[model samples]
Target chain A: MSISEAVVMNGGNGPYSYEQNSSYQKGVAAAAMDMIKEALPTTLDLYHLPLSSPNPIIRIADFGCSTGLTPIQAIETIVQCLLDLIKPIKEPRFRTLEFQAIFSDLPTNDFNTLFTNHLPVRRCYYAMAAPGSFHGRLLPTASLHFAYSSCALHWLSRVPQEILDKSSRAWNGERIYYVNSPAGVVGAYSAQFGRDMEMFLSARAEEMVSEGLIFMVVPGEPDLVHDSQTTLGSELELLGSCLVDMANEGIISKAKVESFNLPIYFPSEKELKQVISRNEFFHIERIQTLSHLKMHVAFPTPESRSLCLRVALEGLLCHHFGNELIIDDLFHRYSLKVAKSLFFLKPESHESISFSV
Target chain B: MSISEAVVMNGGNGPYSYEQNSSYQKGVAAAAMDMIKEALPTTLDLYHLPLSSPNPIIRIADFGCSTGLTPIQAIETIVQCLLDLIKPIKEPRFRTLEFQAIFSDLPTNDFNTLFTNHLPVRRCYYAMAAPGSFHGRLLPTASLHFAYSSCALHWLSRVPQEILDKSSRAWNGERIYYVNSPAGVVGAYSAQFGRDMEMFLSARAEEMVSEGLIFMVVPGEPDLVHDSQTTLGSELELLGSCLVDMANEGIISKAKVESFNLPIYFPSEKELKQVISRNEFFHIERIQTLSHLKMHVAFPTPESRSLCLRVALEGLLCHHFGNELIIDDLFHRYSLKVAKSLFFLKPESHESISFSV
Candidate 1:
């Protein structure tokens, strides 16, 4: 599908949107703040050039900044870390330092809300928004010092070509995702993720100053499982079941169900590390998956989980089906499914990766 | 009056606003564009350090950028000029140059329109908004390349203190402006302008790279004029007369009329240059007043003039008077006054000045 026709979050303050149900995102962002603080000094130390001889402005870009307050929290974290690092630099020339933070997302993202509602409250750095996809170059050559993305890289630039071709060995027949697909289908999905990640890293490498760093937080699958037991994985399974049941009842066409494939992927830790190794634009400083349960005892309830999930996926689903699609009914059934399967659901692990460019 | 209490332009796309009556401003901006294009190459050459040895990003700032399309045109002019200059520089390292344009205005300036409506269509440079008064530091130390302000500097940071002091010799009795006022009132206005301009230059000096340039387009009176002969000056006189007539008919309180004073001033060319020399932050390169008559043969009509004046001053007026004030009636009267006085109206020359830090 063309990018313009693809799903985006419900814009502004719409109900059941990423903008409205953003508590989960805020929690994830808060957890990532410590990791960002830990990584900043080491990242700045690796730069060969001094800070303020020619340019006192340090540049950073946040990829996949959908309409929410999370980008504001993320920016404050990065800006504060930079301030702490710059405070001790005894060089007189480095005394006057400033920061430039650039926020990037798809063209359809509600950047107006980000600028009007979120940016006015921010004070640490000069704020900018660059509207584009992160899988390609969004800034000038070697202009970035640090690049960040939180819970956004799971999206593929486009649906894998192999899945769309019914003749291919990797054809995902009558399924919307790779959860229970054939070996060939799984391989195609993995290959696509690798390609997209490679492009993402390569573009950043070209845009970053030498020794710059990138920090990303992505939804990760639990190890030793082909089918996901994590809440996110299970939720998708539930959503898929709803569609299947609709198809079974003739409420939706079976052919339509078969043709639909979500442009989302959740890689295991091993798959993520392998992609990094394949694309040598960055040296992996650290990579770890933190359990949400271990960090916060009160895991997101089914209702909250469904709201968050709907906010993230509703735009895409609406685009694929129709704007008039019965999203509320779909989510209502998915919420019930989630509640019924609550005890069996495993809390998802968030993958945090830090690397030097 | 406190800045927080003073009226700003009617924000967004209101009936009569900066966004609505911006053609004259645009025409003035186009004239200033030539002055900017002429100054940039010479200013860049004067910098001891090259454009992108340590910092590859060139920065320009536009002060008083409320919600309007004029800023976009202004930025495009500056960016296009820089690109032209950078094209001939064969140095391999300088080939990858980028531009960061910062737009600044008051906290209440309609930046939402700037970001949402105007910025998205712009692709040449990275866009940023710095929210603050220009009379104070709005950027990091030595961080700007070029600073431009057109039709904005006349606004004082706050109403002159003497105007508010009823017992002072400069107390402006039953007048909203200094024109045709007592000698003390003119001195008070001139003193306030001098102070504000000094602060503006001093802050720019600290924020600009050595030999960085500043191009300002401000309203100016012809030589040997204490009271302004400009259209802006005459309109204010007309508006003041309307208020006076209302006061005479007991339609409004006489004390309310006496308490009002506009926080705006249009300086003469000699006065402008004198203040720049006094501050000693910038060396004057070229300062000239261009006749509006020579530039545009058909001066703005009374109807057009009233609309333009209302857009610029209505917010401030509404704040001082009650929001219920019949602004239409006031402008209608003012428009008639303008039409009757048209034959004696002297077209004001806009002052254009370029200086190097």
Candidate 2:
């Protein structure tokens, strides 16, 4: 799925609507804050010197700032780091330092909460909402000192429509990246991802001051094509089957459902580094996978398992499964099946990555 | 680490081990033999029939099965429906089919790997491992029928203490369970894994004439955790500092290293269920977790990250900080300062399970 679609799907009232809710979103914000707090020291060690110089004010941006929570977290961490750095020095030295923070996301994202709710609480920091997809036009050249994003970069704009067609049989039970999805669809998605990544790095490169740091958390697999279990293909298959079943039951038309696809990608660690390396300005300082985080949120119980499946389907699956199916019934049945499946379903092995450049 | 140590550290190795060169372990094994091919379908559907029968052959067992691989995976998808039957079938058709598969681990295990590896596999089979470590003695009341086990459950005896404590850490890096170890060690090792799991399960249950099946796959997770990045806690911290200087000097720690931990676990989906459920006479159909399987094999790359230290040392740092430092180098240095934090590590997840009874 594409970033835009993920935002829209996530934004729409769905099972994962909790992610958009203020309370649940606060957890995300808090987690991001914790991550940033943990990452800031090294980030400062690398970028602080360049940023604190008598040069033009250093600008920083957060790409794919969904709900603007991660940026808020980053801002909070940076603020704390800056306070600590400046507190040790004289007031005169602190007065000479200038910093600007910018948050960017899809034009459709909600930034009001960030400005009205989060920014006002902090002092001596400037925040702005730069509207546009991170993959598209969003920032100016050499305008940023550092960049940060979390749990948002892997979103694609939309599901590949071709995969949903009945004739395509892309939704078959086989666990794979499309039941023979045409090279074109796969290429389009790959190119779009590559393009988005290039845009992300290039945009950051252009916007970031020399020797700037970029810390991001993205979902990834270890091996790309070789690992079937890590791929979303199986989940997609289950989702497709759910949708097809709905369509067959006359709950929704096949046509309406044939144009949707999932918009997320879990890149492998190799794939992530390869993308980062493509941009010369960003040097990787560290990269690691957080396996437990995903596990912590998964399959707490049979009900929770169904809830996750429903959330995944409604928020991400519908975009790929098409909208023709009666989402409510499909979700109900899907939840039942999921609950049943949970009885037999083994624990999921999920991995996430945190990287800094 | 040897199987014994792994058993101690992470619980016990589940089920059996495969001969590294076993043809039955290859992908071609299914095509090579009808028995193997039929194993999954027949065992998977076994629960669909009644349990009691005039035929007097309901109990089943998979002997010499190293950590029930085939059984759990085959039965997980269908175990729940099998367990909810309200009435026994007439003619006792398959009613006597009280199925159980006992998984045996070394006496030293805390049941960590069994829990990590076999538990999920059991969940898949809508079953749970018989609580408690499967070593020493099996329960005396149960009877097992149709026993089977592959490559593993055949280690001759214990891994030699000298080899385990070898002065060279590299010695631990070698695949001791296979050809790399001495003939005596291999024979002794193979026989032990076999005898332990087999004798333990067999003692608890009796064999039946109903023609049960046991299929297994072993010789797994070859990538032992030995590389510098895999080590965590004080060990990892020391190594990281050592590596920084080593990299500066262009030297590798080829020597001066002593023993390292392997943290190995076995119990393919089949063996876990078979051994733990005690031939299903005690009510367990499947058990497995595959996430750890892939995880155990995944090597950390520069781009991949590890959180082992944070998880392992969070408490230690907290104790020293004594609430004076909300976040400090003690916690953030390795995590944030050196760029060697949990943020960059990427480890694979495992999944396994079994089904019976």
Candidate 3:
């Protein structure tokens, strides 16, 4: 979708409604726990901070923290794990060090819901909100101890310029996403993710203390014969077909479908390594792709699994076509398309990566 | 002055023009350096924070940081003194620890001037702004390391309700301040200060770690024979007479002058000690009164000295009268009155006090 019209998870009720359909985020948050634990020991060992230092307060920032209790829930897991790791240490001074947990997101995020109604009364850390974009500097230099973001890195800062220009070679015609699109369209999305990632890393390098750990859960192409050969690719292809079919049926205009493109990309392992190695600020610790079918094993039906994708994409669809677009009809048809694709296509994959700087 | 109508020094120019007439605040900031140093040794000793601790960043908060470069200047001094104190400890881990300087004031305070256009780069510590009032909780509980406030504690969160009530015995009639007012009116202001101090100490107790050093510079009565015997008291008395004479001349309504009272108080030495001792959270560290004339050696001219008072009080007067009131006329009359009083009146005493909790 256009930058100004970029729909974020349905601000109102819909399948893509973050409030009603965030089980996917909850699952992603659960999977991120192990990665956080693996990164903590090295973070604690390498950070040469003293207990009696001027600001003996630990700062943990959760960027792209969406509305709901999940953000706090995720922080509690990290804080509790760190506490356990520190409890065994014999330093009495460490007990007095305070934790300042800063939860940040876009200015439009529901901070009132996050801080006023949902924040727990007896949190181990001091809770505060820094409302801003993560693509730029949010805190002061060398301020953060640990940074964590879940299911958020895939979204680009904005629609790539080449894709939006009608005369540009990268114009994404007849498709709403990069996956399964032409090479030119795919290259444009990849380029935007690379630029956004560079900005993100630079801002983070200035903010993090030496050897601070960063954990990000990203949707990526699984290791296979071809990078785009995955079930998620088929799912997006079917969803695109549904939109085109709607346009043909005169339910929506063809130009409307062409104007809308999801500001997201699923980077392959090679692409991720190229960007990470290019920026010497961070040393890659680990990169692993988790299977979508295995991750969604708790859901016994295809519709349940498809709900996760629909909840996230509905906002962009509704914003571009019209807010009056029937969300239930859209998702119901989309779910059937996904179920049909699954009959012949394989399950897709999502990846998680860690860094230390 | 009504809260909404308070025309704080011409934000662009005039006495309260923090940009032009902050010599008085600068003097107070300089005088505060010694107290901060004294409190630092104890604060560093009792805090028990380790340099290599999890969150080794020291947090120093400057409450009531009005618009100007003085706040930065004052914080640089504190951060430098602190760095010097910590340098001799010989802990390698201390090298990585950073300081976070938080500048806080009322929401309307010129934070834009303090942060965006004025903040210095390549400093020793991280800088940020916390926009809120200090009377209630501002920072997270147990989050602060060292707290300092100068020439600001005199402002009460709200004017005393008793003085505002026309039918109450404590109603301050024909007076714009408590200095030399009727005993009941003076007692109302005193009572308000006591209550506010209690709330202030309690909130700080919850927000500060055990044994955090809090340095406060309060303007109060010296060890004199009479309450109004101080120079500051006489200055206020002279300013009050100017307003009364103006009301008599129909320059301003008599009722207008009677309805306005500054939400400020210069407590006596006895009153200062009583409040600290009453609250168990803090121990009185030091209390001393310095002569305003001696403090303002840089300001040799009577008008220069009067400008300090006029800059701070003009907003209140404009809020009480109309914003359209001629500031030059008001301050000219007030300056002449101050010059006349200085001919015979002893220089006023302004006290400074520090606390450790």
Candidate 4:
């Protein structure tokens, strides 16, 4: 299945929902506000668009805004920046500029909860949601003004095809992610990440105005760090071990474990730069390491850490396994394993990168 | 609470979902196709709008699409008509006309299901959805090209305030609709319908361009038929009697029944005409009754008829009573009563009217 068909954050206003368990994401958005403001242009080029309505509108879309509490903060910041930019404009139409906030995610995403959580803001902006994968064209050509996404680019459009092929050398046999997989598996994951990002950027380039600014927050390691040394790597390793342990004990079929893998790939700063260089339409304005993110403070203990990951991964896991109880048990085991592992040491944690294009 | 908060069709693709139980609405759309084509302008006035884009987009919005299997058919028909209208134009910009189909409903509606069911069509048009009550402005002014709504106008913006007020003479005590209520109660519902329609039209006027057309399908009776004599009136009466029986058996509170009304009003043709005449921006191009609808063929038995009503009203009942079992029991009792009553005669059922404005 395509990642858009199967992956989403846990929905509803419950204990395990992304709405409740996104403190780390919320922290990232809050910390990234100053950078977002600094990167935005002083004057918005709204008049150049082909739109001829007397009342001009600036449409901003937030990609991967699951249940939308954290992403709303980022969206609000961007909207505020644009408002400040146009405050003293001499043109009457520019002074009366309207905005439309479009929250986009997979079609299966929990948009009802997103809209309900952000009801009052509907009066301020023409708030609506577009349902589709970000890796494809979702809006009209040159229809968008600003684009923002937070901590969502780590997801590949789909798992690499070779990793699932039984005959391929790149087939990931035991590992669920590319953390400690074979070198071929790592290559396949890296190649897929490049292709997915290219598709994503190409779609955004078509949908956005020429003068549009896109700020993306993603999880990546520094150039000096190895994939296995990052905190994200350790977490995936612990999760994979838990599944393998369950399979060895004959709880779930080992064949099932071998066939399944998460469709997430956290790139390093070097890898991100390489991918951006290949795309011709956009230039990197700035790529700053977010020093303000306190991952340890956001997720202090193993229990809280497990919850954050659980909310993010539950939909993907449940869709692959077709069992919610198995996911719950796996997360419980992974949390216990985290307590014993060196995960809390947070060795060179790598989930802080904000780049403007 | 507003109608948008409490009202939704049964969600999920289950036996009780609106997706499964909307055969009558589907047939009405299919039957109304001929009239829809005839009334549509032979040439679409797309160039008049102030869009200056190298590529132009024609946006169509379908309001009150519950779970969306039926409204999609109407949307596809309308898009096809516009495509035919623009096929002969020699202008290069007119040759590649793009469309954006926006599906609108209440915030609580199951938009995930709506998007998923129509996934393939997303490639044909940049299809998306907006969440809000259609009685208010949901799109930008002069942004929409074609507006279509089917079988959703009868739902008032909310239950009439006077009908719920204890101090008022119009307080509909123990009656769930205005079928045979007191004169004051009927007047309250009629007034609410008028105000809701006016607001709905005003919003559409602001959202549409000067040459834009809106086609709406609503349920109403002819001028000669009394409100109590119609099949819709008999159906509401049966549902109310079922609730009263449960109340007498100490199953639920009478006050609960008294405080509840359907927020649904089936206007007469004369009433619809009066409301349309009050709105200044729109002129009646054509108002045709859908004679091709085969209500008897669509739902031949009482069990099927009960199911159709259950799928439409279950969410509203569950929201008000705070229990799913009560709604099931109420509908079951109502079904048995329908089998024993004069419902099979079909007694001039009034639920088909299509008008272009």
Cα lDDT of model 3 by residue, B1-357, tens digit: 236224233343334576687766676677677656666675566236522354466778887777677788878888898888877777665666678777766544554445434566457676655545577776765667778887777787767878878899888788777766667877788788898888888988877777576877776655453543444556666777778888888888888878777787777777888987899898876666543325335454668766776767776777668753566777778777766665333443333322222
Q: Per-residue lDDT tens digits of candidate 1, residues A1-357?
A: 354325556667777767777765666677688777776676567336434454466887888878678887788788878777777778665565678788777656776566656665437676666656688777766768888888788888877878878899888877788777777877887788889899999999988888688898876665565633333455566788888877788767777777778888788777788888887778778787643333122335667767777887887777776643477878888878877774325433422222212
The CAPRI class of candidate 4 is medium
TM-score of chain A, predicted model 4, versus the true chain A, to 2 decimals: 0.93
B-chain TM-scores per prediction:
0.90, 0.36, 0.87, 0.93
User: What is the C-alpha lDDT profile of model 3 across A202-251, one tens digit per residue?
Assistant: 99998888867777777666545254444445567677788888778877
Model 2 per-residue lDDT tens digits across residues B1-357: 223322221113321122111222322222213333333454544554323232232333332322323434333322333334314445345443333334333322222222234444213111212222233232222223333343333232344344355553324432323233344433343334545555545544432223333343343322342222222222344424433443345342323222222222233334344444543333443322211212223323321122333332233333333343333333333434324433233322222121112
| Best model number under DockQ | 4
The candidate scoring highest on TM-score is 4
Question: Which structure is stronger by DockQ: 2 or 4?
Answer: 4
Model 4, runs deviating above 4 Å: A41-52, A165-169, A227-230, A323-325, A345-357, B41-52, B165-169, B227-230, B323-325, B345-357
What is the fraction of true interface contacts found in candidate 1? 0.11
Tell me the deviation in Å of residue B188 in model 1: 3.7
* lDDT for B321 (candidate 1): 77
Show what share of the native A-B interface contacts model 4 retains.
Answer: 0.70
The better candidate by DockQ, 1 or 3, is: 1
DockQ for candidate 4: 0.66
Model 4 iRMS: 1.4
Least accurate 10 contiguous residues by lDDT in model 2 chain B:
B14-23
Candidate 3 deviant stretches above 4 angstroms = A1-196, A202-357, B1-16, B50-52, B91-95, B228-230, B290-298, B322-324, B343-357
Residue A250 Cα positional deviation in candidate 2, in Å, after optimal superposition: 2.4
- lDDT per residue, candidate 4, B1-357, as tens digits? 455577778888899988888888887777666667877754346556544357688889988987757767777888888788777778788766688888888888888777777556345678777888898999987888888887889888889889888889987788888877777888888899999999999999998877888888887766676654554666887888888888888888888888878888878878898898999988777676766555556777778878988988887887776652387788888878877776456534534444333
Interface RMSD for every prediction, one decimal? 3.9, 30.7, 6.5, 1.4
